[model samples]
Target: MKITTLTNPRQTILLTSRAGNKDNVMTLDWHTPLSFEPMMYAVSIAKARYSLELVRSSKVFVVNFMSCQFEKEVLYCGRHSGKYIDKFKETSLEREEAETINCPRIKQALGYLECQVQEELEVGDHILFVARVSKAELREKGKRLFHLFADKFTTTEE
Candidate 1:
């Protein structure tokens, strides 16, 4: 049997946002649940990324959990920059207004976590946005898509 050692563990998701009418999406593997009372979550995005700038200015974002059907869209959004192209238009995913935040949520996702930035920490190449969950909705209880080894995408059994 071959055993593999893993250091970091997180399910990559599409962090979508819009700032001043500019909408963008970024792939983020750095995310974790921070609290349960207020339902806080955190995501780390590089300062140079387009989504980071949007989140910084808007102070809000939607964490959309991808499904197995969105593998192509995930890769496209992750590899391409929203500054040059419209990611939403490129992908088949749909967007909807969040209940509490100013950002938009992916309507096709199994669920969404809407948040408002609570704190930001400057970490080496990325800025950690610790946000307080303003609202959450589970449209479907399907499996969640995850990225491993930076390329492979897999789904969890529900």
Candidate 2:
């Protein structure tokens, strides 16, 4: 009887944001498109997460779609905290300036969506951020990463 397993095979993404001079990236499995009329997106982030405050203050974030090649980076970001180390520096994940937002996007990501926070509400221990897509970058097609409980990942590659 494992609840985590029930939510298995979920999409994994790298949520990036910048508050003033600080930038951070975290692995997120709880996010989705909430609307189509206005092209809205939402992400569920814990209150204690370092990126929560950054997103709150900056009111902007980028969702980086990682491919199977970035599995190591995805896992590394999930295991480490931005409060302790510079994830980009430690992981050597390159960054590129987002077109519509002040934050940066992962250069290695298969694609990226720049979002501006439109609304926020508390959902239990997590804050649900509703955002509007301001810009997007789609790179070469690749296998997207999906979380399959714990440290396991499933991809469309093979």
Candidate 3:
């Protein structure tokens, strides 16, 4: 059952933080590691998503690991659009400047991976951003929050 397996996979709300005069954060569910050497990852974002444009123009983003504590913020980011509301200001999620990249990182997250978009492939309603991880930092060594079917939450062992 592809649907069942997909629903059960360890899914984290991948937050892609953009860089610019005004930053934008987008919540993504379709993301995966593409390669291990040099640490490459790919994230699929709908073409209509405002953050997708921001990330494409900047070619850099930060992947923040969402925790259970940020469940509300995560849902808000996914539901709302950056074109209208300022998700960051509305959610009041503190942001810190990333070390290796210009994008901002969610301070509330357990850890973050700063990346630079190396390539992009347009696929259906979404565009896949192939990125190279530039830097990573773990604020706390704890379990990671995840999503499952039926709108359930789970965590992974440390």
- List model 1 lDDT by residue over 1-158, tens digit each: 21112633357789999999888888877788989998999998987898888998999999998877888888889899999998989889888888887788898888889999999999988899999998887788877777766568677777
Residue runs of model 3 more than 4 Å from their true location after superposition: 1-8
Model 3 per-residue lDDT tens digits across residues 1-158: 65546556566665656646777777776888888888998888888889887898889988888777776777778778988877779996887888887778888888888889999999988899999999877788766667675456677776
* Each model's lDDT: 0.85, 0.90, 0.79
Give one digit per residue, the lDDT tens place, for model 2 in 1-158: 86666777888999999988888999999999988777889999998899998999999999999988788999999989898889989997998889898998998888888999999999999999999998876887888999997788888854
lDDT of 2 at 16: 95
In model 2, what lDDT does residue 113 have?
A: 85
RMSD of each: 3.1, 1.3, 2.2
**Model 1, 24: alpha-carbon shift in Å?**
1.0
State which candidate has the highest lDDT.
2
Ranking of all predicted structures according to lDDT, beginning with the best and ending with the worst: 2, 1, 3
Q: In candidate 1, which residue pairs get closer than 3 Å at backbone N, Cα or C atoms, i.e. clash?
A: none
TM-score of each: 0.92, 0.95, 0.87
